[model samples]
Target: MSFYHTPKALSAFDAKFEAQKIAFGPISFQVAHCLLKFEVLATIDQAGEQGLSIAQLAQTNVLNEYALGVLLDMGLSMGLVWLNGDAYVLDKTGYFLLHDDMAAINLNFVQDVCYQGLFQLDKALVAGKPSGLAVFGDWQTIYPALKDLPAEAKASWFAFDHYYSDHAFPQILPLVFAHSPKHLVDIGGNTGKWALSCCEFNPEVEVTLMDFPGQLAVAKDNATKHGFAERIHTFATDLLDESRPFVEGADTYWMSQFLDCFSQEQILSILQRTAQAMTPNSQLFIVETFWDRQPSAASAYCVNATSLYFTAMANGNSRMYHSKDLIKLLHQAGLYVDEDTDNLGLGHTLLRCKRKP
Candidate 1:
């Protein structure tokens, strides 16, 4: 509904180049992967100031000079390499490919967990289910399937999840504790990371970690290992099951990057159940990366693309929501936003809510 304006407009020539980039995105990605896998890019990086000609590269790596030259030509257009005379040198993008944390995380996530499965995006969109999930295993959603994924795939999935959520914890802890709540519920407390954090931050606070049974076992182990076992209670239940009520003794209910895993109807249903458990004094906190609220178009692009992961791999029913859409759902579920704070971490917002008057 909103038109976002960008600072730079592509000239007609640049626009055509952009179109070509989009047309060959998959090929470009695979080339990048091959470059990394074969260490051709790394070798170039090591060559440093002098760079490497195709002759030198071929002789060193035991690759065909012409074939390496063709790939490097592609890299030239991709900004991954530059032609210095007859030699090729690594560019800024090429350097990041080898050393950047964010780049590595994203590349692994896409290649390991998402690449092959994304072919079913159109089918998932039309059927309204994660058809692409079959590539991993036949399951209702990726949550239940996480325990069974290949080790590398699981590593990528958790790494992607943690990279975004973990950094926000330090800044968010102060905000959540400002109300001085004695007991908190960590909804979707995957691996008890946040629960452990809460227990460490406050001596008086007790946390109930709520999650599916498989995840609860991991959380419990993490809590026990960290010496927070007694203070961190585990509640294992399916949040999607309406008959199973949430445990009631909580001054604050926290759902961090959780609600966006379900559809609007499911989110409303979960909120309605959460509402029933809240006392008048209880507060609900929601943390999410709303695409519309991002500071930059690039950040917005990342957030929006995550919706595709939900469509093709995660659940097929949920997405990275717009702030307006989430607020509307909150209003419908009889919760009103009492405080709205943004820019929590990379790109997240915290919504502190109370039962509607």
Candidate 2:
């Protein structure tokens, strides 16, 4: 089931809580986030079973009692905290919200990269462009402007990007190299992390890192520093430009966590061009977080919610896709999924496809 469950029934207290939660969602999020961010949660957790009263926590953190009380009360409703008698204590959800790797990364991404910019999502929807991205810089989209984002924003963006993609690399590397394909083209190979892993995984496999010039610079340096320079090659081109050509002859073309960055029409164009480059024997591998194929409710939540990030900040036209919808794009591109492997390294689905006969 999706994380959003419709209430078949609710008591008056529950209904009232739900209504208030929805009504004050934005400020509630800010309050709960600040509580965790400012170490208020840790303070309460350190107090253990006895818990810490609002005045005690406020004194410890040098925060006002009124502010702390309201935030803590909101956290209680948000499941980030619980009341022990009259005192406040960190709840199980709060512990995870503080310490869980995924939660922390998502939180940082939201606060640093998305929070202020999301104000213009409604405008973005109307214009079919990322209007919210204006908060960061002026550019048609975020990808080309990624290199220019403020330091903290850039860090948060890549951290969010790599967190989801990195976990899948180790699992995907073996599968990609199983065929002993000599030349594997890593489409949108950000920072060459996957290429570095590939070089380490199979020495004989040569890699062509394909992406925009901004990303390729970092990728090339990473490959060089990692001693994969001899085997690693770079292809700098904006795949969005249909006139821009892609190199051919690689037996395998790999797109990892890349396709979701474009609209369906853009995806079709990329795949169509890619299909033309493929020999009858070439295998096209697409690795993406398809919302419908996610392994858990939490993963599905992240995937679906990320669509909004794309909507407001990354690119206004694209989003996380359902597997069936992506498969339709594949067919439109004259390719077919030969194998669809799900549950590969933290909810990623790997589609092993080929040029249609």
Best by TM-score: 1
Worst 10 residues of 1 by lDDT: 1-10
Give the TM-score (vs. native) of candidate 2.
0.94
**Regions of candidate 2 where Cα sits further than 4 Å from its true position:** 1-19
Q: Per-residue CA lDDT of candidate 2, range 145-227, in tens?
A: 88888998889898998888888988987787776788999888877888888889887899998888888989888888988
lDDT of 2 at 168: 91
lDDT per residue for candidate 1 within 1-357, as digits (tens), equals: 233755456699988888888999989988888788789999999888678999899987856987787788999988999988888999999899888877788888988889888999999999899888999888989999997999989999999999998878989999999999799998888788889999999998999988898888988899899999999998999898989979784789999999989999999999988888998889999999999888788788888988999999998989999999999988998999999998889889999999997
TM-score of each: 0.95, 0.94
In candidate 1, stretches whose alpha carbon ends up further than 4 angstroms from where it belongs are 1-8, 59-67
